[model samples]
Target: MKLAATAGGGLFLGFSWTGSLASALEVVSDTAIAAGEINFNSYLALSPDGIVTILSPNPELGQNIKTSFPMIVAEELDADWTKVKVVQAPLDTNKFERQVTGGSGAVPHSWERLRKAGATARHMLLEAAAKRWKVSAGTLRTENGFVLNPANGKKLSYGELATEASKVPVPENVKLKDPKDFKLIGTAVRNVDNHEMITGKPLYGLDFYKDGMLFAMIQRPTAFGLKLKSVDATAAKAMPGIVDVVTFKNNVAVVGKSTWQVSKARKALKVQYEAEAALESSADHDRIFKELLNSTDATVRRKDGDVEAAFKSAAKVIKSEYQCPFLSHSPMEPMNFFAHVRPDGVELVGPTQTPERARDQVAELLKIAPEKVTVQLTRLGGGFGRRLSADFALEAAELSSIIKAPVKVIWSREDDMTGGTYRPAVRYRFEAALDAKGNMIGYKLRGVGMNSGNPTREDNFPSGAVDNLLIDSVEHKSPITTGPWRAPITNFLAFAEQSFIDEVAHAAGKDPVQFRLELLDKAKKSPVGEIKYDIDRMRGVINLAAEKSGWGKKKGVAQGFSVYFSHRSYVAQVGEVELKDNKPVIKKIYAAADCGMVVNLSGANQQVRGGIVDGLGHAMYSNLTFKNGAPEQENFNSYRLIRMKEIPEVDVHFVHNGIDPTGLGEPALPPTGGAVANAIFKATGKRLRNQPFAEQEELKTV
Candidate 1:
């Protein structure tokens, strides 16, 4: 969906895809949305009692997209923000489009579409009031819940004209509110689920339970390459509260009346598995990376100019290697989903980032028509790209189908850590060639990883700035599964790329901030290749970050600078480090983002802060290794997370603009590792090339 915001907040439909817009809105007819009563299909619905309920389509995953999405509709509807009750909308593919949430795309995907919904409803209300007064809608205006006429000083609440508005023709196009005239937007509105959350109400999937529903616990293969061969569940079935024991595919599930019963019974089951592939370990991955990095054969992702010639004639050549261990997507709430597979249809309720995918998967597994499947979305405790995979939901459906009973599959923390998709372990090799004048002439990057796609962003920053650049990758298909983790490749790439750029700048005897500005200027003016980033916005955030952090002027403290553009957002961060006991102590971080517009200031701030903290903690102390195709860090006992006292004060700044908002869920996270690593380098002369910096001697506490 190609959408651009016009000067007057009008939605510009420049859909490049064939028949997508037509097919997406096929469910919404003019009269369907013109109903006088509340419609759950569309986002906005008004009642005769002046009650406004805005449906949030996407699952709430602590990113605050649910609250902010509804705010968009409410803002354009001119409804009282306090009066509107936001509700989680179920997956109605016929009625809603892109009900899934991932890639930090919830806002950018729903922005224009949601605005049109609210504006169209407002247009209907205006016509309803105009018809009642026997006047043209041109003279009618709306404020709060009332449609008004300035000439007569008379107005009618939207509730009063709800019935009459049902007959008004839905406008093909309605003028969207200009950003400058926004009333509820840019305000620090609290999260709609804040009260329910703080009061410990049941909103998350872990809290979801249905009457007569059984709880099932599956015992998956203990190792990645291992497959379940047999399960001796005779003893487990005899245990107390154990309803049944079923073997589906390779997993052995123990079903019971409650979580505790099933969990306790699962321990009694003796599951045996055999290896289907060679058992691989962390040491094996390191060997594979070393072999791939040195191998001449590699897939060239992007090539521009003559890289070999530029490097051969260069006056200086610098080379470095960075590596990161695999990471677990340990969401606070372990994966859980409720599924009821019946003879006629199937029902699925859970916290899933992609509800449609879950529904379709379950339907396919059950050999049922797609229409026979229904999905109900619940609040997610945390996704972090883990919930994007419908594995947990599918497990529930499969078990429920075989057992002929509704069951909720709950993953213990250990099960989740050992049997879930992981962030791929990766190694990046970077080489820079400089001319006699210290100008970068040639740049080369080759990434080696396990199950990572491409692992290179060739069109990102510094790509167009350089005259000669070559990007390539080599992948090792491991038996272990890996999927998107937060910002995906950029989460680790930004740290390596930005840190390398910092090194290049220092080697060229230039300030880090000024050096980045120069690159952005190069990309903006005369370039080499197609640059995907907005140079102006990148420059703006970089300058803003430097200005806000006192980048160069600060004394008795070391500061490092980094910036990255990801998920349609540009974020520049400045990190400060103070040496204590000869160890780099993170003091504070200043973040400046150009996500175009601010939807909710409070939520946006929390997002940036949370991303920074998460990124910092992982880069500094988190790592998941494999000794024999099994995760080494299976729980918090072995896994390291940043403590409250270790968290630095995060100061966030947004480049306020009238442009449509992009994404904040993942963009702010990518640059954080780079900033923190750069700051550590500034404090200590040694460079930390590996992730989970605690593994490096420099970061080890004395």
Candidate 2:
């Protein structure tokens, strides 16, 4: 990519396939890029009206990257935040290599590059001002989009120097501002699109429209291991607004003029599915998982000192089993995509987390090169790892290709809930051996879950945290499709592991927080195998949370504490619960996170709050079960989500360390389940080994 002057004397940042600006030029424009706007490479642009537009390459899924990313650029550029505008960049692999946004690495991945881009612009502007004023470039300083000559107290706006700055040679190296001098970052900046969002503007995938766009809904098989056998759409075709009925390999689609008509026509159609064999049920999964947990044939993921000898010589041993059910992503905006497939190429518009992968999938399906597919991302209502699959976008492309027109496929809440690709059900058996001093001597974990293979992530917490540790995993084969949900394996593992740690603390007659601190200290001083976690960071958050929560001083309310590290971030959470009518009612949650340097304090706080609420909701009531290969829960009525009334006020704190930012989207979530579960145990004296804690019989008893 290279910067060039536009025909209107404005700057243009042109992208080329060969990196050489002379060949294969493409200039993509969006609403954020006004006519005659001065472009500064792929990330930044300046207009004559003093509007600094920053291009955000990553898709925004409520993580506030739309606001935070531009803040990074504006801070380095010395551009006024009030004058900065963030726009979503069109997907260009040659310019921005990775357009995906699932791992919460957008800020970390783009930090240096974006800062450099901004600094480069600042340097060029300084050079232009120096040439005009015949002064030393080093003597000039930029502040809020103005280059100041402190010697004479003279200043010039960036817009005034745009033309001359574009002619200045791009600097190969530029000095970045010190973090201590940062003004925009580490401060609370409201989302740039907050106005658009609250005003109900057209921003999401469902809001996209065309002159003759058709609506489509698919009639998917109810069972997991079933295929569409036959579909009779005789009555559906005769219905009002119905355009046509088409059948794919696995599903039948009802096409119409509107989403409501298509949905109604889908219900009128008669469909049948053929199961390959006896459909697997939740009972079968449980039985197989239990058997596999006990089976000797297992993969040994991690093995340290002799666990057998430690257990044999231990003064006491504790054993427990924990199970978590499958979960759905359940983003507020259900899966929907608009696709226009021509003979030459395909154009897709939607809210997907992985657009590059989706583009490749569409290209492959159409027997064309990957470049033939173009995917434009929209503001996502919610994407808790479900949008990473790209199946919905591919589905829209398939239907559009068949119809030879632009079609939008919309999935109802029922379709999103029962459709495949869910969080896998997992079972964990934990064994802890304690010596006479109440110190945990040995630890063993047997995890059984379904994935393409085993979903057990061996490197999860309490792995390197223990010395005499043995981690084994067993896989149970099933027809149920599963994918990443939020924190993935860590989501369930943290709950089971941390809750078991609380039990160990209770057995040792020690405070949960104290016990965890001791273990973290041990892991820090006397290391084990490949400690991927930062013990100091973990202890920092734990101590901060304990101090902030007034952990041991609370009366009348039972408190539970849990700390976990994932996605290179450490988090500790404490939950306060009160028993009412033989049920545990959560009152508040205290969360401490160490996600390196926070980008947007307000956005980071909201992320932690949302994560804690999401984790609690899933643990307390969310569950997915299958009977005869069909999902038991169809919608919100059956698959329960924590309502506003059930949500507790989350108090968030972050460790103020000057480290590079890690992931914030998922790290705050893992500890919430364990904290809530431990709190329930303290309140009702019941060990809730299974998830959906509301269904526990112990809690049901008065």
Candidate 3:
């Protein structure tokens, strides 16, 4: 590997990658003179000193896109990994595609594009080196920031060739390296921002501050179905550090010099809110679920063979219902955004999962052109799919426009928890029929949810495995707002489906592992319909998980296993539980996944581990319920979260493959609930049909 080359010391480093800082965050650095950096493309910049600047186009939500995405560019560019500096790219739709980071779509969508960007830059450097050496371009190969000629001992650093490479014509397409040659791709690279984060450096949205920016806090409607009717902010306006108090469509905003002042002043405002419609409680949601289950008005997603005949002829039938509560995203950092809105344009700087949509939403609200809005993204403290919506961003933009000055809006933890857009509470019913010999004959699923669209994964798993299978979905609209959770419907659906599969296995008097394997064999050999999951990949993960955990071999340990395919990936998990004081306690979990080629081993491991913890925690202790259109739990005191004491060791493994990468951020999560539920049943002889397993009376301790 060649050393990292630089463009030259004290040369111009001032190239506007995005645009001028149009808002109050107009701090300046870099650029001593003419920009010496060579713009190979929108994503890669080469300095004469052999420094490679790689732009990460997607938002980073601790899923490690910032580190992993740039690894792809560095891998193909043959740049020294230690010298490659990754910077978060601003929202530039013209140069980057798919800036959003949900559905685990970032890597799959940008894999080819990023590889091409690096390959193209490498090609230009080869041409430049060849011209300098007076040799054929094919004779030059790049390695660690250098173009080396094997026939001759001559080599040129990327820094030395940067100036000449800038003049070379970029090819229409460049060859990407074969997967076997990947250097940085699968390597365990540390997060670039780890030092800054551990040192408490300013990086997240909450840390953002400008010279003349004012802080604002909003007082929204207390209830979901209510709206602000009147506001008396006379006292709030008189408070110290208070700047202005204004009302928007549904809430009142208190602007002040600091967060503490705004927080205190917002409490002083007397706001009157009135119900715009009937206020429904958690009980109403429960009744709605029951109504939808019995109602014939359902959309049939998949149908195969004769379900009625199979059920009628079956010697035994097993039926079970599973329920999951609505959940708050509850990121470590509360919702916030910085907005500098002027008559001509707007500047939005904050932590958001969807920057383009945020700019678009603000543009629509203000009746301005999309180009008039510029969004600068900050490192997020956490998202968990919460930042996908632009509600917080819109609040800041609206308040900034009203105040006619740069402003940052912050949401109190209570405001963040009770705010709308929750993971919808859902109910699922599963029924399976078995013949006299205990051979599975039929399978059926009914999903009912509030504000859920196509709550059923009709094409997955047993849909193709069973001889007779049916899947149906019923969506009951409510005043409550709902959007995509981490794994969307699969978060709860997989738990219900996998647990029911386990129950059927037990009813058939077959080993749970053997039962799932048999089903997968059926799906692979003579599938009833088109199977969306790769049977080979799914089998790979399941077998890997079983082997790693020594399935059915651990003594005195209750074990449960679950496998699921979602977000274009397959994951299998084995949960081990131990009995303490006659109560089931989770001890450890083994997870195996096949998400194709991993970008970074360290990041991938952490993502899988984090997902496992998140899924298990929610299933074990988290629940959100509403009373009279208001959330019963506004903060952590009433709400529950997975604590350090409950978090067990999570062992992660991945199938070794060079196949193109799929999604990894959310796939490992969906099956964890089912695995834990199965393990608990083995330990305590109790079936947990609802989320917050600890809250169930049957299991004394979960």
What order do you get sorting by lDDT, best first? 3, 2, 1
lDDT per prediction? 0.85, 0.86, 0.89
Better of 2 and 3 by lDDT: 3
Model 2 local distance difference test score: 0.86
TM-scores for all candidates: the values are 0.94, 0.95, 0.96
Count of clashes, each model? 0, 0, 10
Number of the predicted model whose lDDT against the real structure is largest: 3
lDDT tens digits by residue: candidate 2, 205-263: 98989888899999988898888888889999999999999998798999999999999
Candidates in order: C-alpha RMSD to true structure: 6.2, 3.3, 3.0
Between candidates 2 and 3, the TM-score winner: 3
Ranking by TM-score: 3, 2, 1
Candidate 3 lDDT over 1-702, as tens digits, reads: 013332243223332323433422222223433335556887888877778888887888799999998999888999998778788888888778889989998999999999999999999999999988888999779899899999977888888888789779989978889998888889899999999899999889999999899999999989888988899999999999999999989989999999999999999999999999778899988888898899989999999999999999999999999999999999999999999987668889999999999999999999988887888889998898889999999999999988899999999999999987899889999999999988889999999988988889999898888999899989988888888889999999999999999999999999998899999898888889788888889889989999999999989999999999999999999999999887788999999999989999999999999999999999999989889999999999999999999999999999987888998999999999999999999988888899888888878644
Candidate 3: worst-modelled 10 consecutive residues by lDDT: 1-10
Model 1 C-alpha lDDT versus the unseen true structure: 0.85
How good is model 1 by TM-score?
0.94
292-392 per-residue lDDT for model 1 (tens digits): 99988999988889999999999888899999889998889999999988776788899999999998888788887777777888999898999999999
